[model samples]
Target chain A: MKSKTLVIAVREYLAAVKTKGFLVGLILMPLLMGGGVLVQSFTKGLEDPTPRTIAVLDRTPGETLWAALDTAAVKQNSGTQVLSVPKPRYTLKHIETPTDAAGLDKTRLDLSDRVRRGEVTAVVEIGPNALKPRPTTTPGTEPSEDTAEDSVYFSTNRPALLEVRDFVSRTIQTPVLAARLGQSRETIEAVSKSSRDVLASRGLARKTDTGVSFEPRSNEAATLLLPVAMVVVMLMVVLVGASPLTTNIIEEKQLRIAEVLVGSVTPFTLMLGKLLGGVATSLTLGAIYLGGAAVAARQLEVLDMLSVGLVIWFIVFTIVASMMYGALFVVAGAAATNVKEAQALMTPMMLVVVMPMFLIGPLMNEPHGTIGLAGTFFPLTAPLVTMMRLTTPPPISWWQPVAALLSSGLMTVALVWLAGRVFRAGFLLVGRPAKFRELIGWILKG
Target chain B: MDDAIAIEGVRKVFGDFVAVENLSLRVPAGKLCGFIGPNGSGKTTTLRLIMRIYAPDAGTVRVLGDSRHGPADDRVGYLPEERMLYKSMRVGEVLTYLSRLKGYKPNRIEIDQWLERLALPGVARRRVQTLSKGQTQKIQLIAVLIAKPKLVLLDEPFSGLDPVNSNVMRDAILELKNNGTTVLFSTHDMASAEELCDRIVMIYKGNKVMDGTINEIRAGHNTDTLRVRLANLASNFDNLPGVACAIAEGDHHELQLTPTADAQAILRELQQRGPVELFEIARPSLHDLFVRTVHEGAA
Candidate 1:
């Protein structure tokens, strides 16, 4: 009996695992993820070198202001501007020679006309008189009585408008504050120099707080892992999707082969081989996917999602899911006489699986929340939680996942026992579902 | 030696109807037994019970000694009436596969030998779906015999066979009997049953009506008959003096010689009427007796 079951299992595995589809899934999955990463990095690198050229329209002077703003960070972003229109280096091209308010009105009309026609990006009017300083109103902080006033006019251009705002708040105010405090420009220059070194560290810390980061490297990695894990969990979910009991009943009735096979082999062995075969197929595909991702990450410098912890949990949870579903499906399939009944009976199982798909966002959100903990520990939801936690890193005590794995494993064993009982009777039943009372009696009678 | 098949008081009830009730019979080893009955007369139900296709409600069936082993035992040879052969499989492959399922890997060379013995019309590579009805019948015969079990059970093996294929099957069943293989087959064709069966069990409405050798059954019924032909007529010859009872409307008289009188005396006295062209005396065959016995039993 043992040998027969092993032979059947091996045949099933070989039939599915050696197919070109399996091989393609193994090889293509990683290559695709890795390619995505490489492409993103390539685009990021390209954008890095496409220097940002900012237009200067300060009325004071170019050399002095340029020097003040030419610290390490701003210099890194400056580039040559195209020579389409002849304009001042740091002042407005159409400033009026106004001795009165009428002259200012003419100047305003001329600038407005050019702006509406989209001639220039934006106009910055800066001559100390136009600077308007708003005091910081943070609670418990006294407002500075002596403040520098400057006005910078903004245009309708989106980036240009934003740039003009940034120049006033970031560059002009800092310089003005230091001057009012009787500090030299050299002291302010040192403080700006130190801030650039800490930018990348801040970016890294921000992402660590959120495992599913949108930073080029981690987001692309998370994106790849999300689908891979989703596919794994989905395939495992098929165990629940199509119950073994349902098929067992239908097939036994169809060929009467059940009458023959059951003579020698016990029911447990039969259910075990079938469920294990499905799990084995899933594991094989999972391994292939992970291998592909690993190889691509190495060769193409892409993000790898099949971390040691992820692979372990994925295997553990998928096996549990396969066993549990195999047990449940066998009962369902065995209960059904026809395919239509089987499908109808399976709708609830579908709802059970799809409910988790909706909960996947939460699993992604809180890998160790009430939902995540429920998903991880609950036999029905754990298979997906195991993978979702990889994409959306969950926060909880480390033992939470361990406890989930152990608990679901125990539940799956119970399911295996239940499935075996269903298989023994249901596998050969060709007629209608055993009445609920009968089914329950069968469960207890044994 | 124990009978190859022995069912003692086997009773099967489906809801209210008894499919086979108190059925007790035996087919000794090496004898060809035909299970005969009308449709729904429990011949198939009895055969299925013997094959363990269905368990008897009350009684025991001993096949090759032990009854516990299922029809899947491979020691039993069975060809169901419905004729299930995998259509996608090649004829030879299916033949070999069925043989293998019965625990024998009948070599293609030997399979071809059997096919040739049955005189199969198509090549070995032909798919089963492509074969004509007669040809498929031959394949089924070979599939059962390829394993060559001690007891072979066939249900309506002659249902669709043409004259030629029918003869071919007849020869094959005879050959199995010659080789000491006990065969059990169910059929409605009384002529074939008379020709092939060494003994038969007749069932009706899930109950045993009669079971014995053809000779024993015929003698038991006693519907003895005689056939004669005459060139000229003895007017009212059907009511003639020497012929106590004559059944002839035209020129011939079919007279039943009385038990106390000799048939030769009647034939000589019939010469005055006309020169008789032909004379014969023999008991009725099993078919004649089956109807006579069943009708008489019913009355």
Candidate 2:
């Protein structure tokens, strides 16, 4: 760097780092994130613990289904609590089946009123043929919807109570199967126990010189959380570093300080200086957050899950992304005469910066899929998408990341060059900001 | 002496607006020249062209003997018409930063010295936003001269200053000229231009209307006016022979003469009308010349 540019960079860096807002933001981001997790954990134990009473109208002739449901509820209620918080208990209330359709409608209305008044948590109508075995369907074909004869109608106003639904569905399976087979429940239990060892999932075995060795259980942190976390951190750092450039530049122009600085150095030099300064500021912030995370991970004995190679890649991507976005932000600042105008100009640029976040889910689902590969090659999304793909299962080829870095680096250079031209043309314009077309003209003409 | 700045046939345009056209000028080294013009008369544009802030569409601008088409080197300093400084920065820091940009690494003591010289002592520690308007203007001047450039361009350096501050600034400018630095400033203060400029260049509508020493410019205009003090306040020179118009000055009347009119004949006519205590032919002032040139261009 030229000495003049270096001087400017030093000033710009200090101007940002010395502010109270920077300090507050640096500390607040992690606090808020950590606070959210803490709130979730604390709120988990606070869920309602009152036992739920489910009204059952068993229309089967044997009347054995209610007895089975009562026994199942007792078993579930006796299960151990988690985190010292009791699980929701269930109590079954048997209701006699109506003799006619009119009688059934009156019974249904009474049950609905009871459910609304919280006297009963839900109503379960077990159809007369519920225990009859379903006809077999062909392989790869979906079964038809259950008819009223074999359907178990579980109705509740609180449809979001998924745990209650899961428990009821799981407890009735053995009894329903036993009735159709004309066997005792013990026999069905015995068959289920025998089939329990029929299936298991394991990682692919590696062939060693001694023998084939099975891999250890997958680490969720290393495989799933690490890459997503890294990409999020990269996004945060890049934004924290580059987004402020627009505000700073607009402030300088509005204050009329840009012309004085422009008088001393070339516009490109001034812009490059500010960009480097912003990068330095962002790196400082990232280092603090990452350092804290590292210490915490070490305390949790999960430090090994943090890959050094991934960290290096994080820095490389952060620099490339910051420069690219920083130049665009600088262009926005130069093309506008005030903060409002700059914000208007920056909306599309900001959208492009954040576009990768929306694609993270698809990229994570298929790390080597089309969307992932496309994001890796597209410079704007490469930093985020490529980072996420690196940590997902079924690792991508090595050449993808290398190519992504190269392409993004080249794009950064081109953007900086374009930003320099717009900056030179727009720095002295104190009137209304130039339109997008005018900025394009400046870039091309320069 | 060598020319400090030389512009040959400069033409600058903004969209369809021609800001400067077919203009040429030269200022010798160590001379203080005043660029005088009305608002929107292209004076600031001309100064910007010299500083290379705006490159001419078709012209050559050589500064400090270098003809390269780029920003002026560190040997030249410019204080723009709009006084601007980093409001959040300490005055001393701003000065040091600007000085460094000119390739001069000024220390705190040197910066303090410049502040002291500008009559802005004890302000080096204050943020620019905290300073008053006049103080900020003085600090801006200090920023321009801190590097001691061979040539300095000041656009409306005294625009917002009070009489005392203006005097301080005028003294500082004179000091620069005395120290062999070329100074070119643009202003509408004709009296100051007449008082301080070693040479004057007047522009109207993107063209040079007049350029010369004060005496030379005055000599170029015909001495076709007479100033007289008569005993009677109501004495009118309107009906006098060879007089075009009469304007009242305090305790006197100035009679404008036609091309065929003689100053002696006008004085004689005034004497016949009343007891004339004083009578003399006077050259037009710079203010008059500026107004006349603008009107002529408009016509």
lDDT of each: 0.64, 0.85
User: Which runs of model 2 end up more than 4 angstroms from their true locations?
Assistant: A28-35, A48-142, A148-218, A305-308, A389-400, B249-253, B275-280
Query: What are the DockQ scores of the candidates, in order?
Result: 0.08, 0.50
lDDT by residue (tens digit), candidate 2, A253-339: 777777777777778888998999888887888888889878877776667666787678777888889999999999999899889
**lDDT score of model 2?**
0.85
In model 2, the Cα lDDT at residue A236 comes to 83
Chain B TM-score (each prediction, in order): 0.87, 0.97
Compute the lDDT of residue B31 as modeled in candidate 1: 94
TM-score of each: 0.60, 0.86
lDDT (Cα, tens digit) per residue for candidate 1, span A1-446 = 45545644553455456556556655555456456878887554232222222333444433233345445224433432324322212222434334455865576566656656666545444444332335556898886553222444544444634443564357665665555445667876777688766745211223465574444454544553564455444454344223444554475456544533342245565566666666677677666555655675556544444467666766776677667666677777766677887787678876765566777666555555787667767767666665575455433466766776777678778877877776665665666766777677667853
Instruction: For residues B217-290, write the lDDT of model 2, one tens digit per residue.
Output: 99999998788889888766667888888889888888888889877766667777889898888899999999
